[model samples]
Target: MSSDLWSFALNVYARPGVEDACLRLQTAGANVCLLLCGLWLEQRAVTCDEQRVSLLRTLTEPWDAEVVQPLRTLRMQWKTRAVDDAVLKGMREQIKSHELEAERALLSRLEGVAQAWARNAAGSTTWLEELAGAAASPNRDALQVLRVAATGT
Candidate 1:
């Protein structure tokens, strides 16, 4: 796995089925940032426990709510107008870039929090399940698909 959070995110996100599974989880009210963090921790063999989950949520929820989501909303809202206006399209792209940077920052924060928990133990699907537990109305099957795609189990 890449040492940099952004590079790790890009590689994991590019895996087969990961994007769709993430979208599905996001649609069901999961914070995609937290889910991605869970994947990153799992990749690093960090032991997933309730305390770690709580710490990650405490750190990320506010950032996602305040920064990432609003930028994403604005970018999506401009999609139709951007198609017809080059200037608007450029602005939209800038917003998208900011949103991505926000996500990268969140991932970096998560990595910092998990640094002490890193281990040589084999990764497990438990973190994904625990993280998804708070999702408003998660799709179990979709979560399972993500587990397989992310962990190859």
Candidate 2:
């Protein structure tokens, strides 16, 4: 009944206060990428299957969660449907607010990552190249596309 690495890590890193928890966890040998991904999932309510989890296994070791129930609530809220105009309008506003918050959080994180890489990239040609790639990563591009589509202007 063991889960894959992502599930295990998500189980651990998505807990309340885990972002601040990472300083101690890093001292104990946790992967920063997993820490970041866990935070992202917490903020976005993204989930993965076992296969996807397995793919990330090698990049980081597994961890467990203490509080993921809130995520389930958010997921259920996301699944809810609006039946009438008032309900639909309220739902739409709520969804827009959620999306804006998520997008702002993601972009802020990505900007920090990109900036860190840019700042320390001196003389490390390979690292700089990799950093540049990360700056334009597919996930960021996809997010930009989503934002543009959502705004329609």
Task: State which candidate has the highest lDDT.
Answer: 1
RMSD of each: 2.4, 16.3
**Which candidate has the highest TM-score of all?**
1
Residue 2 lDDT in model 2?
12
For candidate 2, the per-residue lDDT at 21 reads 45
In model 2, residue pairs whose N, Cα or C atoms come closer than 3 Å (at least 3 residues apart or on different chains), thus clashing, are 11-64, 11-65, 12-64, 12-65
Once fitted onto the true fold, the runs of candidate 2 whose alpha carbons sit more than 4 angstroms away are 1-80, 119-153
- Clash pairs, model 1 backbone: none
Model 1 residue runs over 4 Å out of place are 120-124, 134-138, 151-153
User: lDDT per prediction?
Assistant: 0.79, 0.36
